[model samples]
Target: MSLLLQIETATTSCSVALAKDGVVLGFKQINQRNIHAEVITLFVEELLVSAGLKYDELDAIAVSSGPGSYTGLRIGISTAKGLCFALDKPLIAIETLEAMVYGIINADQSAISADTLLCPMIDARRMEVFTAVFSAGGTKIKPTAAEIIDANSFADLLEINKILFFGDGAEKCREVLGAHRNASFLPDFVNSAVHLTQKALEKFRNKEFEDVAYFEPYYLKDFIAGKKAV
Candidate 1:
C-alpha cells in the first residue's frame, strides 16, 4: 500500500493530509492568513500520530507546487523538501490549480456537468490572479497564467461554455465576470492538502518524482516584498 503525506500552504489555507492508496485518510487545515509557518509542521506531526504512521513509513511527500502566495508556497515546499531529504523519500509535486479542480469535483460532483469548465484561481496583486482552466474530469483545458481580470476576461469562453470560477481569487472576479449568464462561482472553496491526494497517487505510480535538492515552488510571478512605513 502506498502512503503519502501531502502538504498545501499555497494559499491562506495551511493544510496537511495523509493518504493511503490514493484515498485520503484525514487532513487538518485552517483557512486563515499568515499562520502557515507556525502550524504546518505541527499539523504534519499530528496527522502522522493520528494515523499511527511514522515519517519514514510514508512512501512519499507531496506538496502543492503553486501559482499562489509566494510566502505560502515557500513554507509548504520547504517543509515537504525537508521531510523528503530527512526521510529519504521521493517528493511529488502537484499544481495548485489542478489540485483545486479535484477539490471542487470531489465536493460538488452533482452540480457539475461534462460541458462545464472549471477555473481555479489564486489571488495575486490588485485584480490579477494566478489561474487556469480545466475540464470537470480533471483535464487541463488551458495553461496556468497570471491574469488581470476585467469585464472582458474570459468573455469568449463564457459565450459557449459554462464556467465555475472559484478559490481565493474568485471573489475579486465576481463583479467582473459574475454578470455573465454562463458564469458561476463556488463561494467558499479553500485550498486543502487532501486535494493533493489524487494527483500525488498518479505521480507516485508513474515514478514522477522531483529532484529533492533542486525543486522550487512555481511562484507564477516574481515576488516583491512590501516596504514597511518609515
Candidate 2:
C-alpha cells in the first residue's frame, strides 16, 4: 500500500490530498485568490490529521510542478521539499498541465472520444496563457507554450481535431475561439491535488523521484518584477 501526500497550488487554488494506493483518502482546498501562502501548510496538516497518517509514514510527497503561477509554484514546491527533507521521503513532481488533463478525464471520461484532444491552459495575463495539447489517451501532442490568444490561434488544429479547451485560461479563450466548430470549452475546471493521485502513483511505481534537495518547479518563464509607481 503506497501512501502519498499531494500538493497543488499551481493556479489560484490551494489544494492538498492524501492518497493511498492511487485512491484519494482525504482532501482540502480553497479557490480564493492570494491564499496559497496562508492555507497550504495548514491544509496539509489538516489532511494528514484527518487521514490519521504521520508525515514519515508517507511513501512519497507529490507536488504539481508548474507552467503556471510563479509564486504559487514556489510555495507548493517549497512546502513539498521541506516535508520530503524532514521525513527523508522521495519527491514526485507531477506536470501541472498533465494533471489538469487527468482531472478533466477523470471527471467525465465519456465526453472525450479517441480523436478528441485536450488543451489545458493556465492564465498568464490578459489575452495570454500557458497551454499544451494532449490526446484523449494522455499523450502530449503539443509541448507547453505561452500563447497569445487571437482569432487565428489553433485554427489549423481546430479544422482537423475536436479539441477540448479548459483550465482557468480557457474561459478567456472561449470568445476568441468560439466561432470554430471544433473548439469546445470546459469552464470551471480548476487544478486540484486530487488530480495528482494517478500520475504520482505511476511515478512512485517507476521510482521516478526527483532529487529532494535540488528539485524545482518548472516555471516556463522568468519572473519579471513589476515597476514601482512613481
Candidate 3:
C-alpha cells in the first residue's frame, strides 16, 4: 500500500493529510491568516502520529503547487521539499485548482451534469482572480490565467455549457455572474489537503515526481510587492 503525505497551504488554510492507496487516513486543517509557517509542520506531525505511521514509511510527499497566495505557496513547497530531502522520498506536485475541482466533484458527484463546467477560482485581489475551467469529468478546458472579472467574463462559454463556479474568488464574482441562466455558484467550497490524495496516488503509481531540489510552486503571475506608507 502506498502511503502519501499531502500538504495544502495555498490560501488562508493550512491543511495536511495522510493517505493510503488514494484514501485519506488522517487529516488536520485550520483556516487562519498567516499561520501556515507555524502550523504546517505541526499538522504533519500530528497526522502521522494520529495514523500510527512514521515519516520513513511515507512513499512520497504531495504538495499543492499553486496559483494562489505567494507566501503560502512558498511555505508549503519549502516544507514539502525539506521533507523529501530528509526522508529521501519523491515529491508529487498537485495543481491547486485541479485539486479544488476534484474536491467539488467528490463532494457532490450526483449534482454535476456531464456537460457542466468547473471553474475553480483563487482570489488574486480586487476584481482579478486565478482561474481555470475543467469539464465535469476533470479534463482541463481552459488553461489557468489571472482574469479580471466582469459581466461578460464567461458569457460565451455559459451560452453552451452550465458552469459551476466556486472557491474564494467566486464570492465576489456572484454579483457579476449571478444573473446568468447557466451560472451556478458554491461559495461554501474550500480547499483542503484531502483533495490531493487521488492525484498524488496517481502520480506515485506512474512514477511522476518533481525534482526535489529544483521544484517550485506554480505562481502563475509575477509577485508584485506593495509599497509601505511613509
Candidate 4:
C-alpha cells in the first residue's frame, strides 16, 4: 500500500488527507483563513486515527507548495518538511495551482472533451491571483502567474473555448474576465485534502519528490512586507 499524507494550506482552506493507491481513505478540512497552523496538525492526527493507521506507517508526505497566501504556504511547507524529517520519508511538493487543476480534471473528465480549459485561480489580494492554464490532458499550457487579471488576462486561452474558473479567487475575476463569451464559472470548487492525496501518490511513483530541506512554496510573487515610516 502506497500510503500518503497530503496537506493543502494554499488558500483559506486547511486540509489533510490520507490515501492509499490514489484512493482517499480519510480527510479533514476547514475553509477559514489563518487557522492552518492551529488546525492542520490536529486534522492530521484525526485523519490517521480515523484511517486506523499510525504516523510511522505513512510511506510519503505531500504538500501543496503555493501560489496562494504567503503565510499559509510557509506554515504548510514547514510542517510538511518537519514531518518528512521526523518520519524519514520522501517529500512530494505539488504546485498549488496545478493541484487545483488536477482536482477539476479528476472531478469531470468529460468537461475537456468539449474543449473546456481548466483555470485554477487563488486570490493574491488587490485584484491579483495565483493562476495558470491547464489543458484537458493536464499539461501546463501557461505557467503560474501573479497577475492582476483584467479584461484580457487570458484573452488567448479564452478564445479557444469556455474556461472553467474556480477556487477562492475565481469569483472575484467575474467583472473583469467573466464578460468574455468563452468564460464560465464553477462556484464551489475549493482545494481539498482528497485531491492532494491522489496527486501526491502519482508524483511519488514518478520520482517527483523534492528535497525536504530545500522545498519551498511557489509564492509566485515576492511577498512584499508592508513598510512603516521610521
Q: Is candidate 3 or candidate 4 better by lDDT?
A: 3
**lDDT per residue, candidate 4, 148-175, as tens digits?**
8888788887887778888989999998
Q: Best candidate, lDDT-wise? A: 3
Question: What are the lDDT figures for the candidates, one per model?
Answer: 0.93, 0.93, 0.94, 0.86
TM-score of each: 0.98, 0.98, 0.98, 0.94
Compared with the true structure, what per-residue lDDT tens digits does model 3 show for residues 28-93?
999888999999999999888888889999999999999899999999999999999999999999
Question: In model 2, what lDDT does residue 51 have?
Answer: 78
Instruction: Arrange candidates, best lDDT first.
Output: 3, 1, 2, 4
Model 4 compared with the native: what TM-score?
Answer: 0.94
Worst lDDT 10-window in candidate 4:
108-117
The count of residue-pair clashes in candidate 2 stands at 0
RMSD, one per candidate, in order: 0.8, 1.0, 0.8, 1.9
The clash tally of candidate 3 reads: 0
Which residues of candidate 1, in runs, are more than 4 Å off?
A: none
Report the alpha-carbon TM-score of model 1 versus the true structure.
0.98
Q: In candidate 3, which residue ranges exceed 4 Å CA deviation?
A: none
How many angstroms is residue 216 displaced in model 1 relative to the true structure, after the best TM-score fit?
0.7
